[model samples]
Target chain A: MEIKLLTEHYDKKEFRFIEGYKKLGGYETLKKAFSLKPEEIINEVKASGLRGRGGAGFPTGVKWSFLPQNGEKRYLLCNADEGEPGTFKDRLMMERAPHQLIEGMIISAYAINSPKSYIYVRGEYNYPIKVLEKALQEAYDAGYLGKNILGSGFDHDMDIYRGAGAYICGEETGMISSLEGKKGQPKLKPPFPAIKGYLGQPTIVNNVETLAAVKYIIRDGAEAYRKYGTEKSAGTKLFSVSGNVNKPGTYEVPLGYPLMDLINNECGGMKNGAKLKAVIPGGSSAPILTAEEVQKTTMDYECLAQMGSMLGSGAVIVMDDSNCMVDMLKVTLHFYHHESCGQCTPCREGTGWIHKIVSSIVNGEGRLQDIDLLEKIAQQMMGRTICALSDAAAMPTLGFITKFKDEFEFFVREGRSKVKEVRAHA
Target chain B: MFKLSDEGINFVKKELARYETKRSAIIPCLYRVQKENDGWVSPESVSYLSELMELPEAWINEVLNFYTMFNKKPVGKLHVQVCNNISCCMLGARELTDHLCKTFNVKPEEISEDGKITISKVECLGSCDTAPMMQINDDYHENLTPGSAEKIIKGMLNGN
Candidate 1:
């Protein structure tokens, strides 16, 4: 069953406007949030067991609690740079319910006692940026923003910073760097964003969905929110289903929902009644799951992690049998190669090298030894970068090569994609 | 020689004051420059912006070069960016790009002879559900077939 905690009003076009949102009880949560003490609000979030929805799955309350106790300037950054290959939920949330994200950010800013926040959206999101700009104006005109919001004597301001075409900016530190007018590169993490970030003050970067969910957490209280999801991964999550699924869009089900159920029930099964071959249960960075393994898998952090994959940004890309694994890896690696910041040697070089190897193989010039070389290079790239982008490139390279070795070997020997040949013959 | 217009200069000034530090205005300011300078940033504009913004040329150039959105070269009026990432590729995005390139009589990343259309393959634009999509200038046209994509580009060329 779909649990519409955050996406309940998403279907309504009126939800995009402030008056419509208010009619549907939009900023009421902000009012509810202000009534509670900041500490109480943090505690409520802590009790809810809500984790970051932006790929990392970190505990939201724990991250908020990391700020220094003394009164110092702080910053809240909402990571709306949703660039993962198969992820599109954040864009939908922002486009459909701009006020929902704004309301959530205001409440979260109040809980953390930060005076300022910025939604670092990707540059290509021209439509969402326009919507947010109009929504921000509405928020200010209605006095939901600016000084003494809602007469609680709390002052908060929000702005939207557009990111140019860099995927690394989705990283928390990379976002802060970009917001500060730099090249959007990820910073070293010993002094994590919680301790020192965004102009060297305490900073908290949450995903769009994570910040939006804060409104619901305050509205329903912690215990009620926890009632939906499992013990570790609590609350509903929006999974962006794409590729060969009959219906490909964002679906919000509670955590621990079966992956098959999401595919079979929500997405209406494989497109054209095609046979399922593989699934990238998370985003592109996650290791791929065979159709057999996907049967027992659930859509929670722990379950996916145990299966050597992750519920990354809750992006589920379904693949039918007609697709070629080697060709798919080529496309995936090409993205990483282009997006690598080149700040770190391992990722900068490894992404390019792997991409070249895959391209060479796709061109029917592969030595069987090249497959093993791909694995060796991928294994070396992991855990040796300033960001997980190195690993992001490496993980999928390893996943596709290992899980679908037979297809690769056949391609190398026959000098053409096995799946393409089968489709051609059929 | 590349200079922002009066309105463009005023927009830059406002952006400079919008952020905490004037340096934070680089991204938005560069975007404005690209818009005023025919869809791409030129080398001379970096120097012009450096002088105007009172920031170093290296600071402006570094930002302009680091991000892909700021085109380093001149492009067609309609910059048609086709998403050829994983999902789009599975839905025949590569074939779509090929078809557009052949029909438009321009290579990928090259402007058409009339300076109207430039077709380039891009990564995901986060609209995979509507796979095989393309972005022309600032707007996205999704769920595209080769014929439909060609029609949209041609329609734009005809000023429709």
Candidate 2:
């Protein structure tokens, strides 16, 4: 069943604007948050068990606790850069409920004692940015923002930063670099963003969905919020279901929902009654699951992780039997190659080499040895970079070849795709 | 030779002071430059912006080159960007792109002879449910068939 804790009013057109949102009981949480101590709000969030809705799945409350008590200037960044393939939930969230996000950010900012925050959105999101801009002005005009917001004596300021076309900027540190007016490249860890980030200040970066969930955590209290999801993965998640499903759209379900039930009950099963072949349970970077594995799978951080795949951004891409695995791998590789920041060598070269190998196979010049070469290159690419771009490229490459070796070998030997009559390489 | 209008200059000045550090304004300033100068940024404008912002040419150039939204060369009046990522590809986005190129009589990434349209295959625009979609300038045209996409482009050309 769909749980609409954060997305209850998403369907209402008035939810997008301040007048509509307030009528629907919006910004009520901000008033509630003001009545409590900052630490009290943090404790409530800690008790809520709300994990990061972004790919990393870090604990939201734990991330906030990392800020040093010594009063240093702090920054709160909202990662609105939703670039992962097969994911469009953030786009929907921003478009439907901009003030919802704004309210959440203000509350989060108060908990962390930060005065300034930026919602770093991707440049391709022209429509979302415009909607957010209008909503932000309304927020400021209504005094939901600016000095002593809601008469709580907690002053906060928020702005929007647009990123040019780079997928690497979705990484937290890379986002910090882009906000700093530099090339969007991922910085090294051990000086994590919570400790020192965004112009060498203690920064907390949360995804659009994760920050939006904060308002609910404060409103419903921690115990009520934990009732929906499992012990570890508490609360509902918005999954962007695409590719071959009859109902290909965003659906919000409680955590630990059965993977098959979402497809059969919610998505109306496969389009045109096609048989399911493979599923990328997370985003494209996650390892693909065979149809059999997807049957027993449940959508949660722990279940997907135990299956050697992580619940990354909750982008469930369903592939029916008619799709060619070789063709799909080529398209996936091309994206990583194009988006690799080149700051790390393994990703830069490995992504290119793997993409070229797949392209050659699709073009009917692949050798049998090329299959093994793909695996060898992918294995070396993992854990050898500043960010997971290398590993992101490597994981799916490894997943496709290991699970669907027959398709690759047949393409190499027969010089054509096994599923389609004509070549589909672009 | 490439100079901002008085209003564009003032917009850049406001952006310069928008963020904590002056260097953070480069992204927004480059966006302003792209808007005023056709649909892309030019090399001459880099020098012009450097002089106007009192920043190094290298710093501005690095930022301009790093991001993909800032087109380096001139594009047509209508920049048609088709999503060719995995989800869209599965839904015949490649065929859609080929269909648009043939109908418009232009190659990918090249401006038409009439200079009104340029079709480029890009990565995902995050609209997977509405696969086979295209973004023309600032607006997105989603859930398209080949016939529908061509019709929409024709409508825009006729100033609808």
Candidate 3:
């Protein structure tokens, strides 16, 4: 069953502002959450089995549990820097429902005993950042954010820190480095943000969607929340569906909902007479699934993982028959190359090499063995970096070349993109 | 004893005065610096900042180098950044970029001779629902088509 719980008020344009947000029973959840014990709040989230919606699908409560009890100046950071290819749900959440996220962050910060919170937004998010900043000012005026929020004896300071437009900052630790006024690059683990983070203090980073969902989790209780979505992946998730779809926008669906239902019922089907070609199940980082595999797939972490892909960042990229896989691969490789951040050597060099090889192939430099080189290089790049960014680059490269080898071969043998060149007249 | 604007130099001095024990105001310093010398990061400002913030000049070099928002090179009167990241990339940002280049008679990386438009690729603009986006000056134009691109360029050209 698809639960439009969080997105219930999205269609209302007034929800973009404060008064409209308040009218929709927006910050009421924080009042409810405040009455409950903070530990009870964490337990409720844990019971719901809500995984991190920001790609990794890690247990959110487990992540909260990782925060050290050492009385350090803990921080709650919201990853609003939605940079994943095809993932726009977070942006929509921020723009349409700013107060919801603010209320959620305050509740979560109170629960985690964090006194300072920052929403590390992408520098490019002009409207959402404005909306969030405006919402923050309103919250501060309402006595919800600064110096003893709601007079619950909780002191939390909130600010919106603009990222200088780095995709790597979407990573939690990388966000911390950026918030601490450093370059937006991912720091190594061992002393994760939970330990030595953001000026050497314990920090708990959650996605904007994840933090917002916490409000719902606390309001409805775990059981009621579990009424929607699957038992393992409870609650509704906002998926930004794009590519060749008739209705391309954000849709709120339950975790275990079938992919076909989402495509046919929600998206209004593909354009023209084009049949489904492939689907990048979750963002660009997830492995590409053929049309047949998409039919068999359920939109969840376990199912996607079983299918050798992931439910990353909840972006469903639907490709149609007219799309050329090889050309898309060239674009994807180019993006990874441009966003490599030059942090680790493997990602720094591998992204460039893969891009060069792919560009050469797309530009009609045919090499029979270049296909195999792509797979081998992608394999070597996996898990050999400071963050999963290297693997994110590798996953799509391997998926594209392996899933659509002939199209790549055709591109190399011919001088132009097989699909684009063929459809030039059409 | 060079003078930026009244508000601009005061902003810089305010930031410069706060970091008394140090001379590396690469970041807090640049906020005011950007207000003074348009949006572009001037090399001389950064050099002066390094001495004021008590940090090495390399610190300024690194901050200016790290982020795309900090334009180390000179830009046109209005710097136009077309977001070519994933969401916008899929939503025909490449076409918008191409259109801007053609209209301005420049490339994606090149600026027009009129010192009006400097087109470049930026990361995600964070407005995914309204994709195919670009930022002219500081305002964002979203859900853009080729015609919209032309209209925006025309508006900027006419100082609208």
Q: Which regions of candidate 3 deviate over 4 angstroms?
A: A422-426, B1-6, B9-32, B51-55, B85-92, B127-129
Candidate 1 chain A worst ten-residue window by lDDT: A417-426
Q: What TM-score against the true fold does each predicted structure earn?
A: 0.98, 0.99, 0.93
Instruction: Please give the lDDT score at residue A359 for candidate 1.
Output: 83
Score candidate 3 by TM-score against the native: 0.93
lDDT of 1 by residue, B17-93 (tens): 99888989999999999999999999899989999999999989889989989999989999999998999989989
lDDT of 1 by residue, A94-196 (tens): 9999999999899999989999999999999999999999999999999999999989999999999999999999999999888988898999987998889
- What is the Å distance of residue A75 in model 3 from its true position? 0.9
lDDT of 3 by residue, B37-139 (tens): 7667777877766665566777667766777777776687777888775556555777778777876787665667876778897665555557777788778
TM-score (C-alpha, index-matched) for candidate 1: 0.98
lDDT of 2 by residue, A50-106 (tens): 999989999999999999998899999999999999999999999999999999999
Query: Which ranges of candidate 1 are over 4 A from the true structure?
Result: A421-426
True contacts kept of 1: 0.78
TM-score of chain B of 2: 0.97
Candidate 2 chain A has its poorest 10 consecutive residues by lDDT at: A417-426
Per-residue error for A94 in candidate 2, Å, reads 0.8
lDDT of 2 at A59: 91
Which should have the higher DockQ, number 1 or number 3? Answer: 1
